[model samples]
Target: MLTQYHIEMNREALGEHFSERALQIITTANINQDRLAGQFGHDEYHFDNNAIDKGNRYINEQRGYILATLIGAGVSPSVAWSAFGRLLHSAQDFYAHSNYVTLWLDENNASSSALEIDPLTKSILLSPKLHTGKVYFPMDVVYFIKPLRSFALKLLPKDSHGWMNLDSPEQGFKFDYAIRAAVKRTKHEFELLQKLLTPEMLAKFVDK
Candidate 1:
């Protein structure tokens, strides 16, 4: 999902379920999650692929340690929520940056009953295929040639990325689908955070 969807749209959607202060905390945390990727010189962290394969367990473990450290060190809930947002971002990307959306569409088209199954379970059932082609050269070398890199990526076929395909409407992308997936992922993250923290600790961040 794009940064706007992750930060603004999701925040608005979540507002229906949470308090104003709680919404603010999660939305701000979401924004910081995107920002921190560039700050740590680990932009790939934003698009980490492991989250897709291992499901919520992986996401919980990755951010869980950091969240625990922050709370253990007496950091504010706002600070810990930021770490949680980082986890949310990765989980959200599992749909946008992977073939999960395509598979879900296929399943939904085949039978409406497929909706009875959990979306995350559907994603877990399919192996993520993020890239269709391989580059023999050091791809990062192109970054040194600014315009050349931009031109190269632009010229490459859209299908080069799992999420993009010129043949499908919405370019094989669906904002609604992405948003729904993000919301589910966020809720899961919130639940996991609640389990990891005490009621008092959780209440500090969310209305509960």
Candidate 2:
């Protein structure tokens, strides 16, 4: 997924699409997650191209746990929503930092109308044979070094892995894909939150 300025900007834009209080909670938590705290646990939360199901399941479990805390443990809705936003950052990254976008494009032949990936295409993307350009160990170390990072990134072929590519004209990224993925994930979050709270309570946290 995009990081630093890109992540900040995307989350800010997403927050602007929501209410003031909601935006505050989301942006605050989103930023925090990008920091050291979010990286404390399994890095799988950051990227797992081959194990999409595991990542999705982990995110869902987190959401459910947060919802339970909000309703049963008397945690503030703001706190719960903040954690939810953190989970969202990872879930959203699944598209940008994985081959899912490329696979989707290949399946649909660059058609913007089809945002949903079919089962077969998803399986193909997740296959171990497919190279998603994911970095590990010393390779990930390049992220801290600007020149080295640039050099390392240049070594990889474009469009074979993730969608974000600063060197490309379109930055090797697709706004439509990112936006659609965000909307779908947000809808799932909203639906789950709605089910866990009363109308009155939900209104306090999200715009009606």
Candidate 3:
């Protein structure tokens, strides 16, 4: 997902439940994941290159950290929210960066306008055909070299992130579906976090 969408979706998902400070911290961390060195190559961070098991492990690890930070004494609030944001980034990217959306459409025999289909309903995670866009040289590396970027993309396979991403509206109607999935996934991540948080901890974590 793009940085702006990450910010927008995270805020939309949790803005009402979290304080302004918590939202800021979370949003900052979410954006930083895209900026930080080596993160782009970390398939677990963006669910890129079909690192499914690694992605799941990363999410679980962050969940544990968020719980520990919230329930354990002396951990910084920023630490918890940071983990929260990182987790959301990967979860959100699952929709935008993977063939899951196409698979969903195929299963339902629907088009991009099929917004009525619940984004989270299908258990396509274990599908043998389910895979994310592969990231590779010249294709992703030359992204900053605008004129050559298109040429570079042509060299990438159909399964490459360059061809598969629904990061923006320009991608097509499927971008809308990705946006919806990402927003809902953000909320779902929060709810999953809540399961680990005590009532008192949850209250302390979110704004009243």
In terms of lDDT, the poorest run of 10 residues in model 1 is 131-140
Error of 3 at 76 (Å): 2.3
RMSD of each: 5.5, 4.7, 1.7
Tens digits of per-residue lDDT for model 1, 1-208: 5566777545754566566765676667666654634424433434433333344464666577545754675666565655666666666665555555556666566443322334466444544543222221333335225568565565554444322412123443354565566567667766666677766666665665
Q: After superposition, how far is residue 133 of candidate 2 from its true place, in Å?
A: 4.9
Better of 1 and 3 by lDDT: 3
| 1 or 2, greater by lDDT | 2
Q: Tell me the spans in candidate 2 whose CA falls farther than 4 Å from its real position.
A: 3-19, 49-51, 111-133, 154-170
Comparing 1 and 3 by TM-score, which wins?
Answer: 3
Per-residue lDDT of candidate 2, residues 130-198 (tens digit): 443344445444544666866655654453232232212244346456445555655556566778877
TM-score of each: 0.64, 0.68, 0.93
| Superposed Cα deviation of residue 119, candidate 3 (Å) | 3.6
Model 3 residue 149 distance off true place after TM-score fit, in angstroms: 2.9
Error of 3 at 181 (Å): 0.4
Best by lDDT, which number?
3
Better of 2 and 3 by TM-score: 3
